[model samples]
Target: MFKGALDNIPDRVKVFLLSLTIMFCMISTVYANFYIGIDKVYTHIFYVPIILAGIWYRRKAIYVALGLGLFYIVACTVHDSIIDPDTILRFLIFLVVAGVVGSLSRARERFHSKELQAERAFRRVAKDLQLVLESTDEGIYTTDIEGRCTLINVAGARMLGYGTEEIPGRKMHQLIHHTRANGTPCPAEECCVSRSRITGVGCRISDDIFWRKDGTAFPVEYSSYPIISDEAVIGSVVAFRDITKRKQADEVRSRLAAIVESTDDAIIGTTLDGIVTTWNAGAERIYGYTAKEIIGRHISLTAPPDVKDEIAGILGRIRSGGRFEHYETVRRKKDGALINVSLTISPIVNNAGDITGASAIARDITENKRVERELQEAKAQAEMYNDLLSHDINNINQIGTGYLELALSAPNLDRGVRELLDRSLEALQNSSRLIHNVRKMQEMKATAGKLAPVDICPLLDEIRAEYSGARNGEVRIDLACGNHTRAMANDLLKEVFSNIVGNAIKHSAGPVHVGIASEEISLNNKTYCKVSVEDNGPGIPDDLKPKLFSRFQRGNTKASGRGLGLYLVKNLVEGYGGRVSVEDRVAGDPSKGSRFVIMLPASA
Candidate 1:
């Protein structure tokens, strides 16, 4: 009851009470000194108020000591007492006690004030720590060295499938971690939290399992941190989180890696600078280099010297995030043999979507390339044989024609023999035409080069003069062309016109009238030169016209020569980036003869 009353007293009231006590003590001392003839005995009572004031008021204790000393001096003088050495000594003692006690009290008050501030700071920190523990998703709890749960946050209680009323004061390991993941015994002594308390060090376990209140277990990644006080291990804090998703992701990656290892194609990984970083078993079988032998080596080790630039180009593209599919190239094997390979390369990206390296799958295409080359060689050989046979047959036909001409020119030759020789000569001419066409077809297949500008007007005139002179007065040839009629064509342009015009004259029954005209035309926004060759012969039937440009196809049975003339003309014209077609000279009249139209790109 006294302690409670002291705590309730205000500072001013306490000071008033102390002053009243000091005044009472001073009066009693004066009464005892003067009336009772006692000096030191009653003066000792003054020490009580002085010491109480020092303890209560700190520096203000000096005023009480000084007040009591002045009263004693005034009382001594009033009582007819002379000031003696003892009195002076007693006055000095009052001042000394006030100074000493006041100074000590001030120091103690300063110390007490600092301690109060420190206590307030500690309270704020504790509040903040509690807020953090309750807010986080991770399970957090503390346990004593004996494995008893001292405190558990809301998250910890929920994570262990327990309520707030049920979690605390229970044995922690027995409540949530009594058994291992595989249903084996896990006592409290062997628990990670207990071990941390004993060892005074933190413990972390990634692949461990923690049981819930329902007797079910889940994979967990957890850390146990020992809480120390006064250099002694007191308890431990365990922070844990579920890791089921992480384990699932690791399993998926393992399966994908297994598939890559089992594939037959060579799978390799290289850094952006072309240094080999990964090589699978397929790479060892295909390139004859194991991962131990080739990893960290430059990718150029497998590339032929001639294809080094090719490898560099591939790396450059991959670095720019470009992917290549089925890129066929050549590489060198371990045995110094060159092999063809088809490569599919893609960039390897990191989590930040930055290109770090490249992955490539290479397939051996050597056998495919070998078969292609063999087929090409066989085709070339067949063409060579065809060219030789055509040349030989043309020579024989020319010899037979020459003999027939000589025999027909005899002065006394019989009419019947002349008629028979003329028929044989015509047959020989037909055979010669077939041979010539075959040779031209072969030349067209083998020729390579771009077409040049050829003046259409002059080429047409030359053909007209030659054909007219050959027929003497039997045919009439007319040419109509502008001065600057030029087309993108080569020397074969003349042969194209020769076949068209010659066919017109040969297929005509009476005097043939062949007219050639050239003009500029626009097709598909591009300029081209259109040349037309018209004759007054039997026009092609609608049904046969479609096949007129086909090899060995004749428009009519009455036609006199091999039917390769129009076919050769179309192939040669189109080879110069031109188009050729035949139409009736007069639209709807089959008897008006045919007109062959040729279109070639106009030279700028």
Candidate 2:
């Protein structure tokens, strides 16, 4: 009740004034016949302001009360009829009692105020710390000594699926369903929160699964420290952080490391400071250096002296966001033997998406290079013979056709001779179609011309609709290209795609379906326009695929005439600077026909 009354004063000055008034009233009793009677209980009212002022104003109120008590006693002495030792002693005793009470009350008030200030300051610091913790992207949570939640930051709340309002003052261990990252339970005895309460220090904990509000689980890392007061454990502040992303990244890194280690190509990495950071098993096999021996060492140690300039150039390009692909070079191995290697170097990007270092994948292509050279020599000799045969065949066919016509027009020819001449012309027609295949093979191998931009979507549609309309078939043309795509010459694309569609229509036993699509593709840092023609028909036999693109090769020689459609397609496409290949349609069953892909440069 007294605390409530003292609470009214807003300032220390008001407390001092109130204390003075009460002290004056208390002294009035001392002068009233100097009779300090039980009615002096009224003087106890003066204790009100004395206690209030002491608690509120401290030393200031104590001094005012003491002065008021003494002044009252001096005024009583001057106004009274007689001066007596008992009166003086009584006045002195009263003065001492008032002073003692004021002093004691003031002391207690100072102590209480200091404690209140300390508490306010602590709360302020906590507010600021909480703001900082929540603002960070990392998860943070705090638990008390009894393993109850005192605070959980926003990031922590999101990670654990528990809000601060939902978990604070609640025992965290009971609510948190602990498990391993792989979903196995983490037994209560080994839990970090329980252990931290027993040990009054901070320690790192790993591989714990934290439960979500909906009962789902995610991995987290827990670090806990006990809060001590007066050398005794009061509570603990445990910081729990969700390490799911970190763990995932670690798994990916491990997988990538395993891939590089198991590969035949040498994979090595260096830090920006020039020290080797990673050396895989492939590196060990090729370079003859154990990973333990070379790691943490400079890469320049094994580099050949002549390659110093090349290495500098590669590093410069990588720093400028360029990749080095198929860069053939020589390097000395640990055995002091020079080895030929094809190096592919790229930048190793950090979490901030900046290149922090570089990686090199080295392939020993010495045998491959040697075999490729031999193959080129053999192919040149064979092509030379084929071209000569095609030229000779063409000349013979022209001479035979001209002579047959000239012989038939002779004035004295008999009906029997005319019939023989007609039979010979029919045989020559069959021979001429066979010769066209050889000519096509030579054309396909000829040097290509510069690629010019051509749009072939409309042309493809035109051919499909025209053929379908002419044949009056149920086959449908599905044109999926919306945007205009540019490729090589129109005539070349038309020849290739028309042959592919025509082949599909001929081979299909039922209603044929055709689809055309175009897109841009990048390969070896160069972009190209790609067009695909797909059909639903009987698939090509695996045995026939070897000769599928060769001249005079046909799936059904009876239905597909002359075996020159695809042969002509191959020649025309290559002459315009493009490539042609086949694959199964994505949506079609294995029984259905396949798709043929034609990749051409958008422009030279």
* Global Cα RMSD, each model: 9.6, 12.6
How do the residues 85-162 of candidate 1 rate in per-residue lDDT, one tens digit apiece? 666677778877877877887787687788888988899899999999999988888887787788888887887788
lDDT of 2 by residue, 1-604 (tens): 6664665656776756785666566566655635644322233444556555565655555565565555545545555545546545654554555567667766766777998899999999988987899798666656666677777778777776766688788877767756665767677567766666677766777877777888888787777777788998777776777787999999999998789878999998987655789898888888899989999998876788877666667777888779888988788799987778899899999889999889999988777877888999988987787668767876787789789989998998999999899678656755675676455445444524634577766876777676673246667777776465677664445657766887777677667788878777878777677878888777776667668888667784335356777767776776766778877775435466788888877654
Reference-based lDDT, each prediction: 0.84, 0.72
Worst 10 residues of 1 by lDDT: 1-10
Candidate number with greatest lDDT: 1
Query: Using Cα atoms with residue i matched to residue i, what is each candidate's TM-score against the true structure?
Result: 0.56, 0.57
The C-alpha local distance difference test score for the whole of candidate 2 amounts to 0.72
| Candidate 1 accuracy as lDDT | 0.84
Q: Itemize residue pairs with steric clashes in candidate 2.
A: 144-236, 145-235, 145-236, 537-593
